[model samples]
Target: MAQITVVQITCGQCGHKFVLNTSTWPSTIQCPYCQEEMSQDMIPRVKEAWGTASDLNMDFARYHADRNETKFSVDLIAEQVHFPHE
Candidate 1:
């Protein structure tokens, strides 16, 4: 049997978690708990209190992206995180 996993997601606007069954992990989803949508902003430094795949700080990536000498693979942050209205 294939092991199923629960992806803990929280809504940035309402701070709601959605743990449900699906075909696969979605890039994004609306929170059924609060009828709010979630995104990377709602995602904490830690994905689920344990830890996230992303670094605690994206300074390194930002620094690289800012540098003109090296070609940055990642896009530099341009906008601030603005949660959806509840």
Candidate 2:
């Protein structure tokens, strides 16, 4: 509700667990599980993110032009159903 916290650290060799930072995202993070180093080259970097979704601004023109059509399927597919409310 207030802010988003994400883990940036992951195992470089095994691609295992992650240790994220609360306030910031690192460029190169070492994996805590495998002790392997991961960097900007290894993983993709994001300029701006709408939560877990990445590559938001990558296709701005195409998406913006077809925004209307994209909205229908996007909204339908994005729906979440929680009957018991977790």
| For model 2, the run of ten residues with the poorest summed lDDT | 71-80
lDDT string for model 2 (5-76, tens) is: 343333437856554563455666666676676556644443233233323333443465677335211110
Give per-residue CA lDDT, model 1, range 16-64, as digits (tens).
Answer: 5556344343455578766665556644432443222223224445555
TM-score of 1: 0.31
RMSD list, candidates in order = 12.5, 10.7
The lDDT for every candidate, in the order shown, is 0.46, 0.44
Clashing pairs in 1: none
Top TM-score model: 2
TM-score, per-candidate, Cα-based = 0.31, 0.35
